[model samples]
Target: MSDAEVWTFNVDDYAAKLQCPTLIIHGERSDGFEAAAQHVFRKVPAQNKKLIIVDGVFHTRFYDDPLVIEPTATEVAKWFKDNVK
Candidate 1:
């Protein structure tokens, strides 16, 4: 098995053990790691689950694009407010 395959397996297993509320934000242009994000998001059993797909955003755009970052932060804040105590 390759290193990437091993990493994927470990990440999926880790995600399956998460029980807290989860907010998954994915860059639509990031084809590389989107499947991993989706696997993690689906594993989380949150009453309030959020998956925000920022269009036209690349993998690293979250650090550079205000347009994507702002909305992601807003949604995450809302998810926390709605779920967390």
Candidate 2:
């Protein structure tokens, strides 16, 4: 099998074994990754899990766009405060 296929093999099993809190950040415009994120979210065993999809931008925009980054950072900070503390 290809490396990508090999890398994803048994991914659900790994996700199921996760015990810590997880925050999944996705861009609403990143349609390609949205389903994959949802799949992993469903598979993860952690009760303290969150999925935040920032609106109006694609994947890479999360790195530079203020509109996306601001909300994403807010969510991340909230997650950290709620879970890490």
Q: Scored by CA lDDT, what does every candidate get? A: 0.77, 0.84
The model with the greatest lDDT is: 2
Task: Give the range of the ten consecutive residues with the poorest summed lDDT in model 1.
Answer: 7-16
For TM-score, the strongest prediction is 2
Write the residue-wise lDDT of candidate 2 on 1-85 in tens digits. 8999897798678899988988888887886888887898899988889887766679998888888788888888988998996
The residue pairs in collision within model 2 are none
Task: Give candidate 2's whole-model lDDT.
Answer: 0.84
- Give the runs in model 1 whose Cα sits over 4 Å from its true position: 1-9, 45-48
Give stretches of model 2 more than 4 Å off: 1-11
